[model samples]
Target: MAKILVVDDAKFMRMTLKNILTNGEHDVIGEASNGKEAVELYKELAPDLVTMDITMPEMNGMDALNEIVASSDDARVIMCSAMGQQKMVVEAIEQGAKDFIVKPFDEARVLEAVARVLR
Candidate 1:
Protein backbone atom coordinates (compact mmCIF):
# COMPACT_ATOMS: atom_id res chain seq x y z
CA MET A 1 0.00 0.00 0.00
CA ALA A 2 1.19 3.47 -0.81
CA LYS A 3 1.71 5.97 1.97
CA ILE A 4 -0.47 9.03 1.30
CA LEU A 5 -0.88 12.49 2.72
CA VAL A 6 -4.35 14.07 2.52
CA VAL A 7 -4.56 17.88 2.51
CA ASP A 8 -7.81 19.85 2.77
CA ASP A 9 -9.10 22.73 4.89
CA ALA A 10 -12.37 20.96 5.61
CA LYS A 11 -12.20 18.25 8.26
CA PHE A 12 -15.07 16.34 6.68
CA MET A 13 -13.38 16.31 3.33
CA ARG A 14 -10.16 15.08 4.89
CA MET A 15 -12.08 12.32 6.66
CA THR A 16 -13.80 11.28 3.48
CA LEU A 17 -10.52 11.02 1.65
CA LYS A 18 -8.93 9.14 4.50
CA ASN A 19 -11.75 6.62 4.39
CA ILE A 20 -11.42 6.23 0.65
CA LEU A 21 -7.66 5.75 0.79
CA THR A 22 -7.96 3.26 3.63
CA ASN A 23 -10.64 1.33 1.78
CA GLY A 24 -8.45 1.27 -1.28
CA GLU A 25 -5.73 -0.40 0.81
CA HIS A 26 -3.53 2.65 0.93
CA ASP A 27 -2.02 3.95 4.14
CA VAL A 28 -2.85 7.55 5.07
CA ILE A 29 0.34 8.66 6.80
CA GLY A 30 -0.83 12.20 7.53
CA GLU A 31 -3.62 14.77 7.11
CA ALA A 32 -3.08 18.51 6.77
CA SER A 33 -5.63 21.33 7.05
CA ASN A 34 -3.79 23.69 4.71
CA GLY A 35 -0.94 23.98 2.28
CA LYS A 36 1.56 25.12 4.88
CA GLU A 37 0.91 22.09 7.00
CA ALA A 38 0.90 19.96 3.91
CA VAL A 39 4.34 21.13 2.91
CA GLU A 40 5.72 20.49 6.36
CA LEU A 41 4.08 17.09 6.64
CA TYR A 42 5.34 16.14 3.21
CA LYS A 43 8.88 16.94 4.20
CA GLU A 44 8.57 14.90 7.38
CA LEU A 45 6.49 11.97 6.19
CA ALA A 46 7.81 11.62 2.66
CA PRO A 47 4.65 9.85 1.65
CA ASP A 48 4.36 8.11 -1.69
CA LEU A 49 1.49 10.35 -2.73
CA VAL A 50 -0.51 13.42 -1.75
CA THR A 51 -4.13 14.41 -2.38
CA MET A 52 -4.25 18.19 -2.27
CA ASP A 53 -7.31 20.45 -2.30
CA ILE A 54 -7.08 23.51 -4.54
CA THR A 55 -8.43 26.21 -2.21
CA MET A 56 -7.48 26.56 1.42
CA PRO A 57 -6.53 29.04 4.14
CA GLU A 58 -2.85 30.08 4.55
CA MET A 59 -1.79 28.61 1.20
CA ASN A 60 -3.53 26.88 -1.71
CA GLY A 61 -2.89 23.47 -3.19
CA MET A 62 -1.24 24.92 -6.26
CA ASP A 63 1.40 26.60 -4.13
CA ALA A 64 1.91 23.47 -2.06
CA LEU A 65 2.26 21.34 -5.15
CA ASN A 66 4.87 23.72 -6.47
CA GLU A 67 6.76 23.64 -3.20
CA ILE A 68 6.72 19.86 -2.99
CA VAL A 69 7.67 19.41 -6.61
CA ALA A 70 10.42 21.97 -6.27
CA SER A 71 11.96 20.12 -3.37
CA SER A 72 11.37 16.62 -4.73
CA ASP A 73 11.24 16.25 -8.47
CA ASP A 74 9.47 12.90 -8.23
CA ALA A 75 6.79 13.85 -5.72
CA ARG A 76 3.38 12.57 -6.78
CA VAL A 77 0.43 14.82 -5.99
CA ILE A 78 -3.18 14.70 -7.18
CA MET A 79 -5.07 17.98 -7.10
CA CYS A 80 -8.66 17.98 -5.84
CA SER A 81 -11.29 20.67 -6.22
CA ALA A 82 -15.01 21.19 -6.56
CA MET A 83 -16.78 21.39 -9.93
CA GLY A 84 -16.23 24.43 -12.17
CA GLN A 85 -12.57 24.80 -11.20
CA GLN A 86 -11.39 23.60 -14.57
CA LYS A 87 -8.95 26.44 -15.06
CA MET A 88 -7.16 25.71 -11.83
CA VAL A 89 -7.09 22.01 -12.69
CA VAL A 90 -5.29 22.69 -15.94
CA GLU A 91 -2.86 24.99 -14.17
CA ALA A 92 -2.22 22.32 -11.57
CA ILE A 93 -1.28 19.79 -14.23
CA GLU A 94 1.13 22.31 -15.70
CA GLN A 95 2.57 22.81 -12.22
CA GLY A 96 3.27 19.06 -11.84
CA ALA A 97 0.15 17.55 -10.31
CA LYS A 98 0.01 13.90 -11.36
CA ASP A 99 -3.76 14.11 -11.79
CA PHE A 100 -6.88 16.08 -10.77
CA ILE A 101 -10.02 14.81 -9.13
CA VAL A 102 -13.24 16.82 -9.10
CA LYS A 103 -15.30 16.82 -5.93
CA PRO A 104 -17.58 15.42 -4.49
CA PHE A 105 -15.20 12.58 -5.02
CA ASP A 106 -16.02 9.30 -6.71
CA GLU A 107 -14.60 6.16 -5.13
CA ALA A 108 -13.47 4.65 -8.39
CA ARG A 109 -11.90 7.83 -9.67
CA VAL A 110 -10.00 8.54 -6.47
CA LEU A 111 -8.63 5.04 -6.37
CA GLU A 112 -7.82 5.17 -10.01
CA ALA A 113 -5.80 8.34 -9.63
CA VAL A 114 -4.05 6.95 -6.59
CA ALA A 115 -3.21 3.70 -8.33
CA ARG A 116 -2.07 5.42 -11.48
CA VAL A 117 0.13 7.84 -9.59
CA LEU A 118 1.64 5.01 -7.55
CA ARG A 119 2.47 3.14 -10.70
Candidate 2:
Protein backbone atom coordinates (compact mmCIF):
# COMPACT_ATOMS: atom_id res chain seq x y z
CA MET A 1 0.00 0.00 0.00
CA ALA A 2 1.25 3.40 -0.99
CA LYS A 3 1.07 6.47 1.22
CA ILE A 4 -1.13 9.10 -0.46
CA LEU A 5 -1.93 12.77 -0.02
CA VAL A 6 -5.32 13.99 -1.29
CA VAL A 7 -5.71 17.63 -2.34
CA ASP A 8 -9.00 19.23 -3.32
CA ASP A 9 -10.87 22.43 -2.46
CA ALA A 10 -14.15 20.62 -1.88
CA LYS A 11 -14.65 18.85 1.41
CA PHE A 12 -16.91 16.19 -0.05
CA MET A 13 -14.42 15.33 -2.76
CA ARG A 14 -11.64 14.98 -0.24
CA MET A 15 -13.69 12.76 2.03
CA THR A 16 -14.90 10.60 -0.81
CA LEU A 17 -11.38 10.10 -2.09
CA LYS A 18 -10.15 9.24 1.38
CA ASN A 19 -12.86 6.64 1.75
CA ILE A 20 -12.12 5.06 -1.62
CA LEU A 21 -8.38 4.86 -1.04
CA THR A 22 -8.58 3.65 2.53
CA ASN A 23 -11.11 1.01 1.58
CA GLY A 24 -8.80 -0.10 -1.23
CA GLU A 25 -6.13 -0.73 1.42
CA HIS A 26 -3.96 2.24 0.57
CA ASP A 27 -2.74 4.56 3.32
CA VAL A 28 -3.97 8.14 3.06
CA ILE A 29 -1.22 10.09 4.73
CA GLY A 30 -2.65 13.62 4.46
CA GLU A 31 -5.25 15.91 2.85
CA ALA A 32 -5.09 19.55 1.71
CA SER A 33 -7.77 22.04 0.73
CA ASN A 34 -5.70 23.99 -1.78
CA GLY A 35 -2.72 23.72 -4.04
CA LYS A 36 -0.37 25.69 -1.80
CA GLU A 37 -1.14 23.57 1.20
CA ALA A 38 -0.85 20.44 -0.97
CA VAL A 39 2.67 21.36 -1.95
CA GLU A 40 3.64 22.10 1.63
CA LEU A 41 2.11 18.90 2.88
CA TYR A 42 3.81 16.93 0.10
CA LYS A 43 7.17 18.13 1.35
CA GLU A 44 6.35 17.47 4.97
CA LEU A 45 4.68 14.10 4.47
CA ALA A 46 6.74 12.80 1.52
CA PRO A 47 3.92 10.57 0.52
CA ASP A 48 4.34 8.00 -2.23
CA LEU A 49 1.50 9.42 -4.27
CA VAL A 50 -0.70 12.51 -4.47
CA THR A 51 -4.24 13.05 -5.82
CA MET A 52 -4.37 16.70 -6.82
CA ASP A 53 -7.33 18.76 -8.04
CA ILE A 54 -6.79 20.76 -11.23
CA THR A 55 -8.58 23.85 -10.03
CA MET A 56 -8.04 25.07 -6.50
CA PRO A 57 -7.66 28.23 -4.41
CA GLU A 58 -4.30 30.00 -3.79
CA MET A 59 -2.31 27.88 -6.28
CA ASN A 60 -3.46 25.71 -9.12
CA GLY A 61 -2.65 22.01 -9.44
CA MET A 62 -0.46 22.46 -12.51
CA ASP A 63 1.74 24.90 -10.63
CA ALA A 64 1.86 22.67 -7.59
CA LEU A 65 2.61 19.63 -9.71
CA ASN A 66 5.43 21.44 -11.43
CA GLU A 67 6.80 22.68 -8.15
CA ILE A 68 6.69 19.25 -6.60
CA VAL A 69 8.33 17.60 -9.60
CA ALA A 70 11.01 20.27 -9.64
CA SER A 71 11.78 19.44 -6.05
CA SER A 72 11.52 15.70 -6.47
CA ASP A 73 11.57 14.18 -9.92
CA ASP A 74 10.03 10.99 -8.59
CA ALA A 75 6.91 12.77 -7.31
CA ARG A 76 3.82 10.94 -8.49
CA VAL A 77 0.71 13.08 -8.85
CA ILE A 78 -2.66 12.05 -10.23
CA MET A 79 -4.72 15.08 -11.26
CA CYS A 80 -8.47 15.34 -10.67
CA SER A 81 -10.50 17.49 -13.04
CA ALA A 82 -14.03 18.07 -14.30
CA MET A 83 -15.25 16.70 -17.63
CA GLY A 84 -14.74 19.95 -19.52
CA GLN A 85 -11.26 20.67 -18.27
CA GLN A 86 -9.35 18.97 -21.06
CA LYS A 87 -6.85 21.77 -21.52
CA MET A 88 -6.01 21.79 -17.84
CA VAL A 89 -5.60 18.04 -17.90
CA VAL A 90 -3.16 18.28 -20.77
CA GLU A 91 -1.25 20.96 -18.96
CA ALA A 92 -1.13 18.83 -15.85
CA ILE A 93 0.29 15.94 -17.84
CA GLU A 94 2.90 18.28 -19.24
CA GLN A 95 3.68 19.39 -15.72
CA GLY A 96 4.53 15.85 -14.62
CA ALA A 97 1.24 14.50 -13.27
CA LYS A 98 1.41 10.73 -13.69
CA ASP A 99 -2.30 10.34 -14.42
CA PHE A 100 -5.77 11.92 -14.00
CA ILE A 101 -9.34 11.25 -12.85
CA VAL A 102 -12.44 13.17 -13.85
CA LYS A 103 -14.78 14.80 -11.39
CA PRO A 104 -17.99 13.02 -10.35
CA PHE A 105 -15.38 10.35 -9.87
CA ASP A 106 -15.88 6.70 -10.61
CA GLU A 107 -14.50 4.32 -8.01
CA ALA A 108 -13.10 1.88 -10.56
CA ARG A 109 -11.39 4.60 -12.53
CA VAL A 110 -9.96 6.19 -9.41
CA LEU A 111 -8.59 2.91 -8.21
CA GLU A 112 -7.21 2.06 -11.60
CA ALA A 113 -5.38 5.34 -11.95
CA VAL A 114 -3.92 5.06 -8.47
CA ALA A 115 -2.86 1.48 -9.04
CA ARG A 116 -1.29 2.27 -12.39
CA VAL A 117 0.74 5.10 -10.97
CA LEU A 118 1.81 3.15 -7.93
CA ARG A 119 2.84 0.25 -10.12
Candidate 3:
Protein backbone atom coordinates (compact mmCIF):
# COMPACT_ATOMS: atom_id res chain seq x y z
CA MET A 1 0.00 0.00 0.00
CA ALA A 2 1.18 3.50 -0.77
CA LYS A 3 1.69 6.07 1.94
CA ILE A 4 -0.33 9.19 1.03
CA LEU A 5 -0.56 12.74 2.32
CA VAL A 6 -3.88 14.55 1.89
CA VAL A 7 -3.81 18.36 1.73
CA ASP A 8 -6.88 20.56 1.72
CA ASP A 9 -8.06 23.58 3.69
CA ALA A 10 -11.49 22.08 4.27
CA LYS A 11 -11.67 19.51 7.04
CA PHE A 12 -14.59 17.69 5.41
CA MET A 13 -12.70 17.35 2.14
CA ARG A 14 -9.70 15.99 3.96
CA MET A 15 -11.83 13.48 5.80
CA THR A 16 -13.47 12.30 2.60
CA LEU A 17 -10.14 11.76 0.95
CA LYS A 18 -8.77 9.97 3.99
CA ASN A 19 -11.72 7.57 4.01
CA ILE A 20 -11.35 6.82 0.32
CA LEU A 21 -7.61 6.25 0.54
CA THR A 22 -7.89 4.06 3.60
CA ASN A 23 -10.70 2.02 2.05
CA GLY A 24 -8.52 1.49 -0.97
CA GLU A 25 -5.91 -0.01 1.37
CA HIS A 26 -3.53 2.91 1.08
CA ASP A 27 -2.12 4.34 4.29
CA VAL A 28 -2.73 8.04 4.92
CA ILE A 29 0.45 9.00 6.68
CA GLY A 30 -0.38 12.68 7.22
CA GLU A 31 -2.81 15.50 6.41
CA ALA A 32 -2.32 19.26 5.99
CA SER A 33 -4.70 22.19 5.85
CA ASN A 34 -2.68 24.31 3.46
CA GLY A 35 0.24 24.35 1.11
CA LYS A 36 2.72 25.48 3.74
CA GLU A 37 1.73 22.68 6.07
CA ALA A 38 1.71 20.32 3.13
CA VAL A 39 5.31 21.17 2.29
CA GLU A 40 6.41 20.59 5.86
CA LEU A 41 4.50 17.36 6.22
CA TYR A 42 5.88 16.11 2.93
CA LYS A 43 9.42 16.68 4.15
CA GLU A 44 8.74 14.85 7.38
CA LEU A 45 6.50 12.03 6.18
CA ALA A 46 8.02 11.32 2.76
CA PRO A 47 4.79 9.75 1.65
CA ASP A 48 4.59 7.87 -1.62
CA LEU A 49 1.89 10.21 -2.93
CA VAL A 50 0.10 13.48 -2.18
CA THR A 51 -3.44 14.67 -3.02
CA MET A 52 -3.28 18.46 -3.11
CA ASP A 53 -6.14 20.91 -3.42
CA ILE A 54 -5.65 23.72 -5.91
CA THR A 55 -7.07 26.57 -3.88
CA MET A 56 -6.31 27.10 -0.19
CA PRO A 57 -5.33 29.66 2.41
CA GLU A 58 -1.64 30.52 3.01
CA MET A 59 -0.39 28.81 -0.19
CA ASN A 60 -1.98 27.00 -3.10
CA GLY A 61 -1.61 23.42 -4.35
CA MET A 62 0.43 24.45 -7.37
CA ASP A 63 3.01 26.08 -5.17
CA ALA A 64 3.10 23.10 -2.85
CA LEU A 65 3.47 20.74 -5.79
CA ASN A 66 6.40 22.79 -7.01
CA GLU A 67 8.00 22.78 -3.61
CA ILE A 68 7.64 19.04 -3.14
CA VAL A 69 8.89 18.30 -6.64
CA ALA A 70 11.88 20.55 -6.10
CA SER A 71 12.71 18.88 -2.80
CA SER A 72 12.30 15.34 -4.15
CA ASP A 73 12.85 14.26 -7.68
CA ASP A 74 10.30 11.47 -7.41
CA ALA A 75 7.48 13.29 -5.68
CA ARG A 76 4.09 12.06 -6.90
CA VAL A 77 1.31 14.62 -6.54
CA ILE A 78 -2.31 14.41 -7.70
CA MET A 79 -3.92 17.83 -7.74
CA CYS A 80 -7.55 18.29 -6.65
CA SER A 81 -9.47 21.17 -8.20
CA ALA A 82 -12.93 22.57 -8.70
CA MET A 83 -14.89 22.12 -11.93
CA GLY A 84 -13.88 25.38 -13.64
CA GLN A 85 -10.20 25.24 -12.80
CA GLN A 86 -9.04 23.72 -16.03
CA LYS A 87 -6.39 26.39 -16.46
CA MET A 88 -5.01 25.70 -13.03
CA VAL A 89 -5.13 21.95 -13.61
CA VAL A 90 -3.19 22.28 -16.81
CA GLU A 91 -0.65 24.44 -15.07
CA ALA A 92 -0.39 21.87 -12.30
CA ILE A 93 0.30 19.11 -14.82
CA GLU A 94 3.02 21.25 -16.34
CA GLN A 95 4.44 21.76 -12.88
CA GLY A 96 4.84 18.01 -12.31
CA ALA A 97 1.55 16.85 -10.84
CA LYS A 98 1.04 13.18 -11.74
CA ASP A 99 -2.72 13.52 -12.16
CA PHE A 100 -5.81 15.34 -10.89
CA ILE A 101 -9.22 14.62 -9.34
CA VAL A 102 -11.96 17.23 -9.71
CA LYS A 103 -14.06 18.10 -6.68
CA PRO A 104 -16.29 16.87 -5.27
CA PHE A 105 -14.23 13.75 -5.66
CA ASP A 106 -15.38 10.48 -7.15
CA GLU A 107 -14.30 7.44 -5.16
CA ALA A 108 -13.43 5.34 -8.19
CA ARG A 109 -11.60 8.17 -9.92
CA VAL A 110 -9.60 8.97 -6.82
CA LEU A 111 -8.61 5.37 -6.38
CA GLU A 112 -7.79 5.01 -10.04
CA ALA A 113 -5.57 8.08 -10.04
CA VAL A 114 -3.80 6.87 -6.92
CA ALA A 115 -3.23 3.44 -8.41
CA ARG A 116 -1.97 4.87 -11.67
CA VAL A 117 0.37 7.28 -10.00
CA LEU A 118 1.70 4.58 -7.71
CA ARG A 119 2.46 2.40 -10.67
Candidate 4:
Protein backbone atom coordinates (compact mmCIF):
# COMPACT_ATOMS: atom_id res chain seq x y z
CA MET A 1 0.00 0.00 0.00
CA ALA A 2 1.15 3.51 -0.77
CA LYS A 3 1.44 6.28 1.79
CA ILE A 4 -0.91 9.13 0.92
CA LEU A 5 -1.45 12.74 1.86
CA VAL A 6 -4.99 14.13 1.47
CA VAL A 7 -5.49 17.85 0.92
CA ASP A 8 -8.93 19.46 1.07
CA ASP A 9 -10.41 22.53 2.69
CA ALA A 10 -13.56 20.80 3.88
CA LYS A 11 -13.41 18.64 6.97
CA PHE A 12 -15.99 16.18 5.70
CA MET A 13 -14.28 15.77 2.39
CA ARG A 14 -10.95 15.06 4.02
CA MET A 15 -12.55 12.57 6.40
CA THR A 16 -14.40 10.83 3.59
CA LEU A 17 -11.21 10.50 1.56
CA LYS A 18 -9.29 9.17 4.55
CA ASN A 19 -11.94 6.54 5.18
CA ILE A 20 -12.04 5.45 1.57
CA LEU A 21 -8.28 5.20 1.18
CA THR A 22 -7.79 3.46 4.50
CA ASN A 23 -10.53 0.98 3.68
CA GLY A 24 -8.84 0.34 0.39
CA GLU A 25 -5.72 -0.69 2.29
CA HIS A 26 -3.65 2.40 1.65
CA ASP A 27 -1.81 4.22 4.42
CA VAL A 28 -2.90 7.82 4.98
CA ILE A 29 0.19 9.63 6.21
CA GLY A 30 -1.25 13.13 6.58
CA GLU A 31 -4.08 15.56 5.87
CA ALA A 32 -3.97 19.25 4.98
CA SER A 33 -6.65 21.94 4.71
CA ASN A 34 -4.92 24.08 2.11
CA GLY A 35 -2.36 23.87 -0.65
CA LYS A 36 0.35 25.60 1.35
CA GLU A 37 0.01 23.12 4.16
CA ALA A 38 -0.19 20.32 1.64
CA VAL A 39 3.16 21.28 0.16
CA GLU A 40 4.74 21.55 3.57
CA LEU A 41 3.31 18.23 4.63
CA TYR A 42 4.42 16.65 1.40
CA LYS A 43 8.01 17.60 2.13
CA GLU A 44 7.83 16.50 5.77
CA LEU A 45 5.86 13.30 5.19
CA ALA A 46 7.30 12.34 1.81
CA PRO A 47 4.19 10.36 1.03
CA ASP A 48 4.00 8.22 -2.09
CA LEU A 49 0.87 9.93 -3.33
CA VAL A 50 -1.24 13.01 -2.73
CA THR A 51 -4.89 13.85 -3.35
CA MET A 52 -5.08 17.61 -3.76
CA ASP A 53 -8.11 19.87 -3.93
CA ILE A 54 -8.15 22.28 -6.85
CA THR A 55 -9.60 25.32 -5.11
CA MET A 56 -8.43 26.52 -1.71
CA PRO A 57 -7.97 29.71 0.31
CA GLU A 58 -4.21 30.08 0.83
CA MET A 59 -2.99 28.31 -2.26
CA ASN A 60 -4.71 26.58 -5.14
CA GLY A 61 -4.03 22.97 -6.08
CA MET A 62 -2.45 23.92 -9.39
CA ASP A 63 0.19 26.00 -7.67
CA ALA A 64 0.76 23.32 -5.07
CA LEU A 65 1.01 20.64 -7.71
CA ASN A 66 3.59 22.66 -9.58
CA GLU A 67 5.57 23.30 -6.46
CA ILE A 68 5.46 19.68 -5.40
CA VAL A 69 6.50 18.49 -8.80
CA ALA A 70 9.26 21.03 -8.84
CA SER A 71 10.43 19.88 -5.45
CA SER A 72 10.21 16.23 -6.41
CA ASP A 73 9.83 15.23 -10.00
CA ASP A 74 8.48 11.87 -8.93
CA ALA A 75 5.70 13.45 -6.86
CA ARG A 76 2.41 11.81 -7.72
CA VAL A 77 -0.58 14.10 -7.29
CA ILE A 78 -4.19 13.41 -8.15
CA MET A 79 -6.23 16.55 -8.34
CA CYS A 80 -9.73 16.75 -6.86
CA SER A 81 -11.90 18.73 -9.20
CA ALA A 82 -15.54 19.65 -9.65
CA MET A 83 -17.46 18.89 -12.84
CA GLY A 84 -16.87 22.34 -14.29
CA GLN A 85 -13.14 22.40 -13.62
CA GLN A 86 -12.08 20.65 -16.81
CA LYS A 87 -9.83 23.51 -17.82
CA MET A 88 -8.08 23.47 -14.50
CA VAL A 89 -7.80 19.68 -14.63
CA VAL A 90 -6.11 19.81 -18.01
CA GLU A 91 -3.70 22.41 -16.72
CA ALA A 92 -2.97 20.27 -13.71
CA ILE A 93 -2.18 17.31 -15.90
CA GLU A 94 0.12 19.49 -17.91
CA GLN A 95 1.75 20.61 -14.69
CA GLY A 96 2.55 16.96 -13.89
CA ALA A 97 -0.40 15.70 -11.88
CA LYS A 98 -0.58 11.94 -12.20
CA ASP A 99 -4.38 11.95 -12.51
CA PHE A 100 -7.60 13.49 -11.22
CA ILE A 101 -10.98 12.69 -9.61
CA VAL A 102 -14.21 14.63 -9.82
CA LYS A 103 -15.75 16.04 -6.70
CA PRO A 104 -18.84 14.46 -5.14
CA PHE A 105 -16.30 11.68 -5.28
CA ASP A 106 -16.94 8.12 -6.31
CA GLU A 107 -15.37 5.67 -3.91
CA ALA A 108 -14.62 3.14 -6.59
CA ARG A 109 -13.19 5.72 -8.94
CA VAL A 110 -11.11 7.30 -6.22
CA LEU A 111 -9.65 3.99 -5.20
CA GLU A 112 -9.03 3.01 -8.78
CA ALA A 113 -7.23 6.24 -9.50
CA VAL A 114 -5.11 5.86 -6.41
CA ALA A 115 -4.28 2.25 -7.20
CA ARG A 116 -3.36 3.07 -10.75
CA VAL A 117 -1.11 5.94 -9.79
CA LEU A 118 0.54 4.00 -7.03
CA ARG A 119 1.14 1.10 -9.33
- TM-score for each predicted model, relative to the true structure: 0.99, 0.98, 0.99, 0.98
What is candidate 2's CA lDDT for residue 84? 95
- lDDT by residue (1-119, candidate 4, tens digit) is 89999999999999999999999999999999999999999999999999999999899889999999999978999999989999999999999999999989899999999989988
Comparing 3 and 4 on TM-score, the stronger one: 3
The regions of model 2 sitting more than 4 angstroms off are none
lDDT of 2 by residue, 1-119 (tens): 89999999999999999999998999999999998999899999999999999888899888889989998978999999999999989888987899999989899999999999989
Tens-place lDDT digits, model 1, residues 1-119: 99999999999999999999999999999999999999999999999999999999999999999999999978999999999999999999999999999899999999999999888
Q: Lowest-scoring 10 consecutive residues by lDDT in candidate 1?
A: 110-119
Candidate 4, residue 44: the lDDT equals: 99
Highest lDDT: give the candidate number: 3
lDDT of 3 at 118: 93
Show model 1 residue runs off by greater than 4 Å. none
Worst window of 10 by summed lDDT in candidate 4: 57-66
Superposed by TM-score, candidate 4 places the C-alpha of residue 55 at a distance from the truth, in angstroms, of 0.3
The residue-by-residue lDDT of candidate 3 on 1-119, one tens digit each, is 99999999999999999999999999999999999999999999999999999999999888999999999999999999989999999999999999999999999999999999999
Model 3 CA deviation exceeding 4 Å by range: none
Query: Pairing residues by index, what is the TM-score of model 3?
Result: 0.99
Candidate 1 lDDT score relative to the true structure: 0.96
lDDT of each: 0.96, 0.94, 0.96, 0.95
